[model samples]
Target chain A: MERTPPHPEVSAFDLQLVLEALVDPVRRSIVTQLAVTGEDRACGTFDLPVSKSTATHHFKVLREAGLIRQYYVGTSRMNALRRTDMDQAFPGLLDALTTPRAVAR
Target chain B: MERTPPHPEVSAFDLQLVLEALVDPVRRSIVTQLAVTGEDRACGTFDLPVSKSTATHHFKVLREAGLIRQYYVGTSRMNALRRTDMDQAFPGLLDALTTPRAVAR
Candidate 1:
Protein backbone atom coordinates (compact mmCIF):
# COMPACT_ATOMS: atom_id res chain seq x y z
CA MET A 1 0.00 0.00 0.00
CA GLU A 2 1.26 3.50 -0.83
CA ARG A 3 1.16 6.02 1.96
CA THR A 4 0.04 9.56 1.22
CA PRO A 5 2.05 12.53 2.46
CA PRO A 6 0.44 14.66 5.12
CA HIS A 7 -0.85 18.09 4.11
CA PRO A 8 -2.34 20.84 6.20
CA GLU A 9 -6.11 20.97 6.21
CA VAL A 10 -7.65 23.73 4.13
CA SER A 11 -9.11 25.19 7.28
CA ALA A 12 -5.66 25.04 8.84
CA PHE A 13 -4.01 26.91 5.98
CA ASP A 14 -1.64 29.57 7.27
CA LEU A 15 -1.28 32.74 5.22
CA GLN A 16 2.33 33.15 6.21
CA LEU A 17 3.18 29.59 5.22
CA VAL A 18 1.39 29.91 1.91
CA LEU A 19 3.14 33.17 1.13
CA GLU A 20 6.47 31.68 2.11
CA ALA A 21 5.98 28.71 -0.14
CA LEU A 22 5.03 30.91 -3.07
CA VAL A 23 7.87 33.35 -2.48
CA ASP A 24 10.36 31.24 -4.33
CA PRO A 25 10.35 31.73 -8.12
CA VAL A 26 10.42 28.01 -8.83
CA ARG A 27 7.49 27.37 -6.52
CA ARG A 28 5.57 30.26 -8.01
CA SER A 29 6.18 28.87 -11.49
CA ILE A 30 4.97 25.48 -10.37
CA VAL A 31 1.78 26.95 -8.94
CA THR A 32 1.19 28.96 -12.09
CA GLN A 33 1.61 25.85 -14.23
CA LEU A 34 -0.74 23.86 -12.03
CA ALA A 35 -3.28 26.67 -12.12
CA VAL A 36 -3.16 26.80 -15.92
CA THR A 37 -3.23 23.05 -16.35
CA GLY A 38 -6.03 22.49 -13.87
CA GLU A 39 -4.83 18.91 -13.43
CA ASP A 40 -2.37 16.87 -11.48
CA ARG A 41 1.14 16.85 -12.96
CA ALA A 42 3.91 14.39 -12.32
CA CYS A 43 6.73 15.90 -10.29
CA GLY A 44 9.09 15.33 -13.21
CA THR A 45 6.80 17.23 -15.54
CA PHE A 46 7.81 20.57 -14.08
CA ASP A 47 10.68 22.07 -16.02
CA LEU A 48 12.43 23.28 -12.89
CA PRO A 49 16.01 24.50 -13.26
CA VAL A 50 17.08 22.98 -9.97
CA SER A 51 18.39 19.55 -9.13
CA LYS A 52 15.94 16.77 -8.31
CA SER A 53 16.55 17.16 -4.57
CA THR A 54 15.97 20.88 -4.79
CA ALA A 55 12.81 20.31 -6.79
CA THR A 56 11.62 17.84 -4.19
CA HIS A 57 12.24 20.38 -1.46
CA HIS A 58 10.10 22.94 -3.29
CA PHE A 59 7.26 20.41 -3.63
CA LYS A 60 7.44 19.64 0.06
CA VAL A 61 7.22 23.33 0.87
CA LEU A 62 4.12 23.73 -1.26
CA ARG A 63 2.50 20.62 0.22
CA GLU A 64 3.21 21.63 3.79
CA ALA A 65 1.80 25.07 3.12
CA GLY A 66 -1.48 23.51 1.98
CA LEU A 67 -1.05 25.21 -1.37
CA ILE A 68 -0.87 21.88 -3.24
CA ARG A 69 -2.02 18.31 -2.78
CA GLN A 70 0.16 15.37 -3.70
CA TYR A 71 -0.55 11.69 -4.17
CA TYR A 72 1.21 8.73 -5.64
CA VAL A 73 0.14 7.30 -8.99
CA GLY A 74 1.94 4.08 -9.77
CA THR A 75 5.66 4.92 -9.81
CA SER A 76 5.17 8.67 -10.21
CA ARG A 77 4.17 11.24 -7.61
CA MET A 78 1.56 13.65 -9.00
CA ASN A 79 0.79 17.12 -7.65
CA ALA A 80 -2.14 19.46 -8.06
CA LEU A 81 -2.90 22.93 -6.83
CA ARG A 82 -5.30 23.04 -3.91
CA ARG A 83 -7.19 25.87 -5.58
CA THR A 84 -10.37 25.40 -3.60
CA ASP A 85 -8.47 25.30 -0.33
CA MET A 86 -6.51 28.44 -1.24
CA ASP A 87 -9.62 30.29 -2.39
CA GLN A 88 -11.37 29.43 0.85
CA ALA A 89 -8.46 30.72 2.88
CA PHE A 90 -7.47 33.83 0.97
CA PRO A 91 -10.10 34.43 -1.66
CA GLY A 92 -8.71 35.65 -5.01
CA LEU A 93 -5.15 35.28 -3.78
CA LEU A 94 -4.21 32.46 -6.12
CA ASP A 95 -5.48 34.28 -9.15
CA ALA A 96 -3.63 37.43 -8.23
CA LEU A 97 -0.44 35.54 -7.55
CA THR A 98 -0.57 33.45 -10.69
CA THR A 99 -1.89 36.01 -13.15
CA PRO A 100 0.65 36.58 -15.89
CA ARG A 101 2.06 40.10 -16.01
CA ALA A 102 4.84 41.92 -17.78
CA VAL A 103 7.19 41.88 -14.82
CA ALA A 104 9.14 45.15 -14.97
CA ARG A 105 11.80 43.75 -12.67
CA MET B 1 16.89 67.45 4.00
CA GLU B 2 14.22 64.72 4.14
CA ARG B 3 14.68 62.12 1.47
CA THR B 4 12.02 59.60 0.59
CA PRO B 5 13.25 56.05 0.28
CA PRO B 6 13.39 54.52 -3.17
CA HIS B 7 10.71 51.97 -3.99
CA PRO B 8 10.23 49.75 -6.96
CA GLU B 9 7.97 51.35 -9.52
CA VAL B 10 4.42 50.09 -9.64
CA SER B 11 5.19 48.57 -12.99
CA ALA B 12 8.25 47.00 -11.46
CA PHE B 13 6.46 45.24 -8.65
CA ASP B 14 7.41 41.59 -8.44
CA LEU B 15 5.07 38.94 -7.04
CA GLN B 16 7.89 36.86 -5.64
CA LEU B 17 9.38 39.79 -3.75
CA VAL B 18 6.01 40.87 -2.44
CA LEU B 19 5.22 37.35 -1.24
CA GLU B 20 8.62 37.06 0.37
CA ALA B 21 8.04 40.28 2.29
CA LEU B 22 4.55 39.30 3.42
CA VAL B 23 5.63 35.83 4.48
CA ASP B 24 6.88 37.21 7.78
CA PRO B 25 4.15 37.48 10.39
CA VAL B 26 5.45 40.75 11.77
CA ARG B 27 5.56 42.31 8.32
CA ARG B 28 2.09 40.98 7.58
CA SER B 29 0.80 42.57 10.78
CA ILE B 30 2.35 45.86 9.82
CA VAL B 31 0.74 45.72 6.40
CA THR B 32 -2.59 44.83 7.99
CA GLN B 33 -2.38 47.78 10.30
CA LEU B 34 -1.58 50.07 7.42
CA ALA B 35 -4.46 48.66 5.43
CA VAL B 36 -6.87 49.30 8.27
CA THR B 37 -5.56 52.76 8.99
CA GLY B 38 -5.32 53.90 5.34
CA GLU B 39 -2.63 56.41 6.27
CA ASP B 40 1.02 56.76 6.91
CA ARG B 41 2.27 55.53 10.30
CA ALA B 42 5.37 56.23 12.25
CA CYS B 43 7.83 53.42 12.73
CA GLY B 44 7.51 53.69 16.50
CA THR B 45 3.74 53.51 16.28
CA PHE B 46 3.53 49.80 15.40
CA ASP B 47 3.08 47.53 18.44
CA LEU B 48 5.61 44.95 17.37
CA PRO B 49 7.02 42.58 20.01
CA VAL B 50 10.44 42.40 18.43
CA SER B 51 13.45 44.54 19.21
CA LYS B 52 13.90 47.93 17.57
CA SER B 53 16.55 46.54 15.25
CA THR B 54 14.41 43.59 14.28
CA ALA B 55 11.47 45.84 13.54
CA THR B 56 13.75 48.05 11.49
CA HIS B 57 14.90 45.02 9.55
CA HIS B 58 11.36 44.00 8.81
CA PHE B 59 10.44 47.48 7.67
CA LYS B 60 13.40 47.52 5.33
CA VAL B 61 12.33 44.17 3.95
CA LEU B 62 8.86 45.52 3.25
CA ARG B 63 10.16 48.68 1.69
CA GLU B 64 12.64 46.91 -0.54
CA ALA B 65 10.03 44.43 -1.65
CA GLY B 66 7.92 47.36 -2.95
CA LEU B 67 5.04 46.46 -0.66
CA ILE B 68 5.40 49.72 1.30
CA ARG B 69 6.82 53.20 0.90
CA GLN B 70 8.79 55.08 3.54
CA TYR B 71 9.74 58.68 4.05
CA TYR B 72 10.99 60.96 6.77
CA VAL B 73 8.75 63.32 8.70
CA GLY B 74 11.00 65.42 10.94
CA THR B 75 12.75 62.93 13.24
CA SER B 76 10.34 60.10 12.50
CA ARG B 77 10.09 57.77 9.54
CA MET B 78 6.56 57.09 8.31
CA ASN B 79 5.55 54.01 6.36
CA ALA B 80 2.57 53.54 4.12
CA LEU B 81 1.29 50.58 2.14
CA ARG B 82 1.97 50.84 -1.57
CA ARG B 83 -1.65 50.04 -2.21
CA THR B 84 -1.83 51.68 -5.62
CA ASP B 85 1.33 49.99 -6.79
CA MET B 86 0.34 46.63 -5.39
CA ASP B 87 -3.07 46.79 -6.94
CA GLN B 88 -1.64 47.78 -10.26
CA ALA B 89 0.67 44.81 -10.13
CA PHE B 90 -1.46 42.10 -8.56
CA PRO B 91 -5.04 43.39 -8.65
CA GLY B 92 -6.93 41.91 -5.64
CA LEU B 93 -3.82 40.55 -4.00
CA LEU B 94 -3.70 43.05 -1.13
CA ASP B 95 -7.31 42.57 -0.12
CA ALA B 96 -6.95 38.81 -0.24
CA LEU B 97 -3.80 38.99 1.86
CA THR B 98 -5.12 41.37 4.51
CA THR B 99 -8.70 40.23 4.95
CA PRO B 100 -9.34 38.93 8.44
CA ARG B 101 -9.74 35.16 8.56
CA ALA B 102 -10.48 32.46 11.13
CA VAL B 103 -6.99 31.06 10.44
CA ALA B 104 -7.59 27.42 11.29
CA ARG B 105 -3.87 27.09 11.87
Candidate 2:
Protein backbone atom coordinates (compact mmCIF):
# COMPACT_ATOMS: atom_id res chain seq x y z
CA MET A 1 0.00 0.00 0.00
CA GLU A 2 1.28 3.47 -0.82
CA ARG A 3 1.38 5.74 2.23
CA THR A 4 0.63 9.37 1.67
CA PRO A 5 3.08 11.92 3.07
CA PRO A 6 1.20 12.02 6.38
CA HIS A 7 0.39 15.64 7.13
CA PRO A 8 3.80 17.31 7.58
CA GLU A 9 4.77 16.46 11.13
CA VAL A 10 4.53 19.29 13.65
CA SER A 11 7.58 20.38 15.56
CA ALA A 12 8.94 23.50 17.23
CA PHE A 13 9.91 24.62 13.73
CA ASP A 14 6.33 24.19 12.58
CA LEU A 15 5.11 26.11 15.60
CA GLN A 16 7.49 28.92 14.69
CA LEU A 17 6.29 28.79 11.10
CA VAL A 18 2.66 29.18 12.16
CA LEU A 19 3.43 31.94 14.65
CA GLU A 20 5.49 33.89 12.15
CA ALA A 21 2.80 33.30 9.54
CA LEU A 22 0.05 34.93 11.61
CA VAL A 23 2.21 37.79 12.91
CA ASP A 24 1.28 40.14 10.09
CA PRO A 25 -1.78 42.35 10.67
CA VAL A 26 -3.05 41.71 7.17
CA ARG A 27 -2.65 37.97 7.68
CA ARG A 28 -4.31 38.18 11.10
CA SER A 29 -7.22 40.00 9.53
CA ILE A 30 -7.44 37.32 6.89
CA VAL A 31 -7.53 34.64 9.59
CA THR A 32 -10.22 36.50 11.54
CA GLN A 33 -12.26 36.79 8.36
CA LEU A 34 -11.79 33.08 7.70
CA ALA A 35 -12.79 32.18 11.26
CA VAL A 36 -15.93 34.30 11.11
CA THR A 37 -16.87 32.80 7.78
CA GLY A 38 -16.55 29.33 9.40
CA GLU A 39 -15.29 27.79 6.17
CA ASP A 40 -12.79 28.23 3.39
CA ARG A 41 -12.96 31.43 1.37
CA ALA A 42 -11.37 32.65 -1.81
CA CYS A 43 -8.39 35.01 -1.48
CA GLY A 44 -10.15 37.72 -3.41
CA THR A 45 -13.14 37.67 -1.09
CA PHE A 46 -11.34 39.73 1.56
CA ASP A 47 -11.90 43.46 1.18
CA LEU A 48 -8.23 44.28 1.74
CA PRO A 49 -7.50 47.68 0.23
CA VAL A 50 -4.04 46.64 -0.95
CA SER A 51 -3.22 46.19 -4.59
CA LYS A 52 -3.74 42.79 -6.20
CA SER A 53 -0.01 42.04 -6.18
CA THR A 54 0.26 42.92 -2.50
CA ALA A 55 -2.76 40.76 -1.74
CA THR A 56 -1.21 37.88 -3.60
CA HIS A 57 2.05 38.37 -1.72
CA HIS A 58 0.22 38.37 1.59
CA PHE A 59 -1.66 35.19 0.71
CA LYS A 60 1.55 33.53 -0.40
CA VAL A 61 3.20 34.47 2.88
CA LEU A 62 0.28 33.02 4.81
CA ARG A 63 0.39 29.82 2.80
CA GLU A 64 4.17 29.38 3.11
CA ALA A 65 4.07 30.02 6.85
CA GLY A 66 1.63 27.12 7.26
CA LEU A 67 -1.06 29.25 8.86
CA ILE A 68 -3.63 28.27 6.24
CA ARG A 69 -4.11 25.29 3.97
CA GLN A 70 -4.89 26.13 0.38
CA TYR A 71 -6.16 23.69 -2.22
CA TYR A 72 -7.62 24.11 -5.68
CA VAL A 73 -11.36 23.55 -5.48
CA GLY A 74 -11.93 24.04 -9.20
CA THR A 75 -10.56 27.25 -10.75
CA SER A 76 -10.67 29.16 -7.42
CA ARG A 77 -8.22 28.27 -4.65
CA MET A 78 -9.90 27.90 -1.26
CA ASN A 79 -8.08 29.03 1.85
CA ALA A 80 -8.92 27.84 5.37
CA LEU A 81 -7.23 28.31 8.72
CA ARG A 82 -5.14 25.32 9.77
CA ARG A 83 -6.72 25.27 13.20
CA THR A 84 -6.52 21.49 13.59
CA ASP A 85 -2.81 21.25 12.80
CA MET A 86 -2.08 24.26 14.98
CA ASP A 87 -4.17 23.00 17.89
CA GLN A 88 -2.47 19.62 17.75
CA ALA A 89 0.98 21.22 17.71
CA PHE A 90 0.23 23.62 20.52
CA PRO A 91 -3.12 22.99 22.16
CA GLY A 92 -5.17 26.08 23.10
CA LEU A 93 -2.52 28.26 21.46
CA LEU A 94 -4.68 29.35 18.53
CA ASP A 95 -7.67 30.04 20.77
CA ALA A 96 -5.60 32.19 23.10
CA LEU A 97 -4.05 34.15 20.26
CA THR A 98 -7.37 34.82 18.52
CA THR A 99 -9.73 35.22 21.47
CA PRO A 100 -10.76 38.80 22.19
CA ARG A 101 -10.52 40.02 25.77
CA ALA A 102 -13.29 42.13 27.29
CA VAL A 103 -12.57 45.65 28.43
CA ALA A 104 -12.68 46.45 32.14
CA ARG A 105 -15.89 48.02 33.28
CA MET B 1 16.13 68.35 26.90
CA GLU B 2 16.17 66.15 23.83
CA ARG B 3 14.43 62.80 23.38
CA THR B 4 16.16 59.60 22.28
CA PRO B 5 14.70 57.76 19.25
CA PRO B 6 11.49 57.50 21.38
CA HIS B 7 11.42 53.72 21.06
CA PRO B 8 10.81 53.25 17.29
CA GLU B 9 7.02 53.06 18.02
CA VAL B 10 5.09 49.80 18.19
CA SER B 11 2.44 48.81 15.67
CA ALA B 12 1.06 45.74 13.95
CA PHE B 13 4.19 45.69 11.85
CA ASP B 14 6.21 45.64 15.00
CA LEU B 15 4.14 42.71 16.19
CA GLN B 16 5.02 40.87 12.99
CA LEU B 17 8.67 41.69 13.53
CA VAL B 18 8.55 40.27 17.03
CA LEU B 19 6.70 37.13 15.95
CA GLU B 20 9.11 36.45 13.11
CA ALA B 21 12.04 36.97 15.43
CA LEU B 22 10.89 34.34 17.91
CA VAL B 23 9.76 31.80 15.31
CA ASP B 24 13.16 30.15 15.05
CA PRO B 25 13.71 27.25 17.46
CA VAL B 26 17.26 28.39 18.23
CA ARG B 27 15.99 31.89 18.94
CA ARG B 28 13.15 30.57 21.07
CA SER B 29 15.61 28.52 23.08
CA ILE B 30 17.69 31.65 23.56
CA VAL B 31 14.63 33.57 24.77
CA THR B 32 13.75 30.77 27.19
CA GLN B 33 17.29 30.80 28.47
CA LEU B 34 17.16 34.57 28.92
CA ALA B 35 13.82 34.34 30.71
CA VAL B 36 15.19 31.77 33.10
CA THR B 37 18.30 33.82 33.72
CA GLY B 38 16.14 36.93 34.34
CA GLU B 39 19.26 38.96 33.58
CA ASP B 40 20.83 39.80 30.29
CA ARG B 41 23.56 37.39 29.24
CA ALA B 42 26.39 37.71 26.76
CA CYS B 43 26.04 36.19 23.28
CA GLY B 44 28.89 33.81 24.01
CA THR B 45 27.17 32.56 27.15
CA PHE B 46 24.73 30.20 25.44
CA ASP B 47 26.35 26.92 24.42
CA LEU B 48 24.44 26.71 21.13
CA PRO B 49 25.50 23.62 19.21
CA VAL B 50 25.69 25.59 15.98
CA SER B 51 28.84 27.09 14.54
CA LYS B 52 29.90 30.62 15.46
CA SER B 53 28.62 32.00 12.18
CA THR B 54 25.28 30.24 12.54
CA ALA B 55 24.97 31.49 16.12
CA THR B 56 25.66 35.02 14.95
CA HIS B 57 23.06 34.68 12.23
CA HIS B 58 20.47 33.47 14.71
CA PHE B 59 21.23 36.42 17.02
CA LYS B 60 20.84 38.84 14.11
CA VAL B 61 17.50 37.30 13.19
CA LEU B 62 16.34 37.65 16.79
CA ARG B 63 17.52 41.25 16.94
CA GLU B 64 15.87 42.22 13.67
CA ALA B 65 12.58 40.55 14.64
CA GLY B 66 12.21 42.82 17.71
CA LEU B 67 11.64 39.89 20.05
CA ILE B 68 14.74 40.78 22.06
CA ARG B 69 16.56 44.01 22.76
CA GLN B 70 20.33 43.89 22.44
CA TYR B 71 22.65 46.56 23.70
CA TYR B 72 26.31 46.97 24.42
CA VAL B 73 26.78 46.81 28.17
CA GLY B 74 30.49 47.46 28.64
CA THR B 75 32.66 44.95 26.80
CA SER B 76 29.80 42.46 26.46
CA ARG B 77 26.46 42.74 24.67
CA MET B 78 23.31 42.08 26.71
CA ASN B 79 20.02 40.68 25.44
CA ALA B 80 16.56 40.81 26.99
CA LEU B 81 13.11 39.88 25.72
CA ARG B 82 11.10 42.90 24.58
CA ARG B 83 8.16 41.91 26.77
CA THR B 84 7.05 45.47 27.49
CA ASP B 85 6.77 46.66 23.89
CA MET B 86 5.13 43.40 22.81
CA ASP B 87 2.64 43.48 25.70
CA GLN B 88 1.62 46.99 24.73
CA ALA B 89 1.20 45.99 21.11
CA PHE B 90 -0.95 42.83 21.65
CA PRO B 91 -1.65 42.52 25.37
CA GLY B 92 -1.20 38.94 26.69
CA LEU B 93 -0.33 37.52 23.29
CA LEU B 94 3.27 36.78 24.26
CA ASP B 95 2.37 34.87 27.42
CA ALA B 96 -0.04 32.73 25.47
CA LEU B 97 2.68 31.87 22.97
CA THR B 98 5.43 31.01 25.45
CA THR B 99 3.60 29.20 28.25
CA PRO B 100 4.03 25.43 28.20
CA ARG B 101 1.11 23.10 28.84
CA ALA B 102 1.11 19.92 30.92
CA VAL B 103 -0.13 16.69 29.43
CA ALA B 104 -3.32 15.24 30.87
CA ARG B 105 -3.41 11.88 32.65
- Number of the top candidate by DockQ? 1
Instruction: Summarize candidate 1's per-residue lDDT along B38-104 as a digit string, tens digits.
Output: 9999999999989999998999999998988998888899999989888877888888877776222
Model 2 lDDT tens row, A4-36: 211344453355556666767777788777766
User: TM-scores, in order shown?
Assistant: 0.90, 0.59
Q: Which ranges in model 1 have alpha carbons more than 4 Å from their true place? A: A102-105, B102-105
Task: Give the DockQ-based CAPRI class for model 1.
Answer: medium
Q: Identify the candidate with maximal lDDT.
A: 1
lDDT of every predicted structure (CA atoms): 0.84, 0.65
Query: Which candidate ranks first by TM-score, i.e. highest?
Result: 1
The RMSD (Cα, Å) of candidate 1 is 2.2
Runs off by more than 4 Å, candidate 2 = A1-13, A23-29, A36-39, A47-66, A69-75, A91-105, B1-13, B49-65, B71-73, B101-105
